[model samples]
Target: DQTSKTSYDLVVIGARWTGAVGEYWRSKTTYEVIKTIQPPVLVAIGEREQLKRFLVCTGGKEFIEQAVQFTGRLAAAVNASVTLLHVMAEPPAVYADMVRLEENVDQLLESKSELGTNLRRQKRELERLRVSADVRLRHGIVIDQVFEEAREGDYDLIVTGTSQARGLLRHYIMGDLTRSILNRAIVPVLVARAGPAKPGRTLWKAIKGLVRTR
Candidate 1:
């Protein structure tokens, strides 16, 4: 008899814009975004886990460098691995244009030419950081694909970012992807809010400061 054994310390689902943003913050700030998350309940699991792996699910639209950097840091801190997953949704024939846009890997790579360059640089950094990492491209619903991977990979935890709500009504409504993953995920989940902070401003400010100094 053979036992199927796969394990990871952590797995982050939903590699959307928010996830990328979270990665950026984590890389730059000394403050622990996951630890300092509002409500405190969200990151409890991540804090408790010793060995962690981050599995970031992307739609192929997001910049891979951000995810790589974030995971690289977490992995180095926890001595874990970072895995990237890209999921594709199928559409009807009438949506050929949309399908072409989504399915054309070459075009997608070309479109984010700068991001691709950044990813290469980050990959080198990740290697120096000694974090094991790999990227996978798959086809299916984002939520379903993540769940399936979680089970198969035997991930101990999943982390994702949420949207800040404006009011009580908005708070009650979970974004579709978050809602689905939360409802179906078998493992513990860490939800971080991707608040409306302008992450780029810090870089811009630094640039301006350099100009003044010069």
Candidate 2:
């Protein structure tokens, strides 16, 4: 495939509001293109100015490092400020009793928790790249927190990472966080996927499924 054959620095795509409209009427082309493409995709929305402030939402996932590095490089190139944000959403059942969502950034960074360590490491990495960044903490719904930070910070771009999900139906029916941000973001969103390249066969299968469901 062309994606496998050639290296890409970034893929820019447009985003729009489709939530009010029925899912069946929504175009699948954007989601499909984002899924198949390997490069970091920038879903541009609304009006934008010269790229400056960047709000990077980090979840300490496998792709977080890659996404942070990507944003760091971009920020370094443009001399933009970056704020690393992690929302303390409701914990899963495994850690629901133990995890607290109200800890401040200073407290989180000082603790020995995995999230704390990852935040500190990412900040150091950004500094190593000669990019200045501040770590911020939030609580409540992940997407809502992100939107709040973006507006309050007046950020130029939002950087995020996504974990791979199998099959197009999952992407279509249960849209992932990154895609959700893309669809609703007022500013541009940069999404980086880390893992093996999604095979062409999977794309074909997903397309077939889309057709069958339609």
Candidate 3:
């Protein structure tokens, strides 16, 4: 048997899913592939030739550029409706923190001068591309909220992109979020990483100190 295999430069599957969104991909997963084939998780809902609705998940600035450009280009190409979703998670705590977090989330979502400015900028960029889009803000568990919205609406694909340049803290925390969404999402999750897949092991440590130390 040919034991050696190369990474998938781009793998687009059909709409038909045997089980969960990533189950098919997961079942076929290999340690070799998983290590090197890490890319942004862009989840496609159903098997269709053209996308009708696309969901762009944004919050962190690291991935926003890739997220916006990719979403805009794809939406304009297919003339799909874009829903820019930013899921704000309540701070982890009890009564006081919960209430405060809720209030803060409310403020950001309600105030035109807050998150609204960012959303407007996003809208303007898409408008320049001639791809009309609407902004949506939701509060709760980030992954849960995203899934709930995906189910309620007719989103054809879910676009989530971010990069943290291999940090210790980020690896344990934010890494889980991305992995969880990819594993659990009923829709397609696109996690965009900018680079080519390599032939060696995936997690090759290159950084000597904390990124913030500099």
Candidate 4:
């Protein structure tokens, strides 16, 4: 329930065998299970056994901690390089900022201040695990910018987060950006869940899973 103090990412798990949402929705009679789960469920469509590079999508502080920790652990496990990316979504026309003549909209919305602070926090977290990564800033639609970076970098995986949005507002936030990336990405996208486990637990679990799988 939204009223609960516990925080975790809300994920809608469907059949791995099918990409069609309509078909997957019919997997169970109940849909409320999306809100609660004991262990995080991970589904990876990409078949890579070794991770080399990562493209992490961020939205300032909105990017969940679990995702950042998971990404760092995975990178440490495989000696992978990571690139943190943040896209400044186009602003409304009324308070319109400067736009590039060739591109749709190009302007600064304190991407440096917001994304900069986040970059430092994440890098510090990664440093605790001895994982160093690069940071990149871009401008445009969030989903589109992410996909483009993924394509250009040929990242082994795309690690991102989904907010625990509730009610009708959720419809506008959680499903759109993540689902869009999931739909078009050729690599695996790990949806980082929030709450519990802490960073230490997350890394320990990932190392164990890697051992078992590899």
Candidate 5:
């Protein structure tokens, strides 16, 4: 007997860094991060279908595997695709310096060699992950680019990491990228806790386990 496939249910945005890390570290394992969020149930049962998509916004190799895992699981259950976006926001001066360094590669052979090696490593990683993904890198402000992509791509959901606000004034003002994105995003947003782990019972439990083992 052929099992019927479940319809697509959700779309997840910003899967690369914060969302990936949060999903990996969270104790709950059943949650599926997709590119969009659909109603829990549809009117038609057998013929009903929902196409979910997940957009992963990444800058580097950090937490990419976790994002892929989440997307793969969701896609297996329902038709879905993972889109990876990389934003390079280095200032124009930095870009010029890189250009100059490239031009002087013969003069600075050692330094240029190291830089080339690092760039190759990054490219290799990106290539490996991009095998099953739509990957693109752009240069601009991260939040602006993310918002623009979401709008242009017609994403339905956004998953992102959120860091705790520091300082009384800043906290009150919500003067942070996470807050800015949350405020401006038109679709549903999942804000993952991106702060340092709090020292709590888990620490004590680990200490006790060590003591017992000793």
Candidate 6:
């Protein structure tokens, strides 16, 4: 009943794998905690430093906007650079050539597609907060593509979002995907949520107020 009863502004956990035998159970427990939590989670794996470059992952899913909004506010705080990344899964061989998954952000924006439109909306949202972000596209398995991009881009932080469905349904939906990213990511991963869980509270309003006052 914790997921149904409690909420938080943020849930932060440290990550340090010793490569021991017991690390398996430790990882499993961490994943469970992440899936059940109702707010954003930050899995910190290394030393804390100034976050200069942020890689925000967007799949046009539930919390993409929230993730971008939060990132924009945080970036504004330190005057950091932001990059919006959208990853496409490898296509079937039959349609591989037609998909042209290699198309970059600029090329995609020129076309009329849902993904392009979503990216534009997210970019505009960042612009509203006075943060200009670079848009990038990749093709492969979601997690793999993200890892590759993180290494190639040398980003300081990785921001991703998932559905906030609770209990059993949540486990089947995005638990693995979210957990996997946190487990393997070399940089800190900010798992953004739709909003606060309880009524009479709005995370966006609080963030906006902070940004304005800054």
Q: lDDT values of the candidates?
A: 0.51, 0.75, 0.59, 0.60, 0.44, 0.73
Alpha-carbon RMSD to native, per candidate: 13.6, 10.5, 8.4, 14.2, 13.8, 10.9
lDDT tens digits, residues 28-110, model 2?
A: 86677676666777777666868889999888543468778888999999999889988887667787545553356777777
Error of 6 at 97 (Å): 5.6
Instruction: Name the runs in model 6 displaced over 4 angstroms.
Output: 1-8, 17-29, 92-97, 166-173, 195-214
Best candidate (score: TM-score): 2
TM-score of 6: 0.73
Task: List the candidates ranked by TM-score, beginning with the highest.
Answer: 2, 6, 3, 4, 1, 5
Q: In angstroms, how far off is 133's CA in candidate 6? A: 0.5
lDDT (Cα, tens digit) per residue for candidate 4, span 159-201:
7655554444432123577666666656666666543222336
Worst 10 residues of 2 by lDDT: 166-175
The local distance difference test score of model 3 is 0.59
| Candidate 1 structure quality by residue, lDDT tens digits, 40-69 | 123222233454666655433233344445
- Residue pairs in clash, model 4: none
**Any idea what lDDT model 5 has?**
0.44
TM-scores for all candidates? 0.49, 0.74, 0.61, 0.60, 0.43, 0.73
Give candidate 4 misplaced runs (Cα > 4 Å): 1-35, 91-112, 165-173, 195-214
lDDT of 6: 0.73
Regions more than 4 Å wrong, model 5: 1-51, 93-132, 162-175, 191-214
Model 2, total clashes: 0
Task: Give the CA lDDT, 0 to 100, for residue 46 in model 1.
Answer: 24
- Considering every candidate listed, which one attains the maximal lDDT? 2
Residue 198, model 4: Cα distance from true site in angstroms: 18
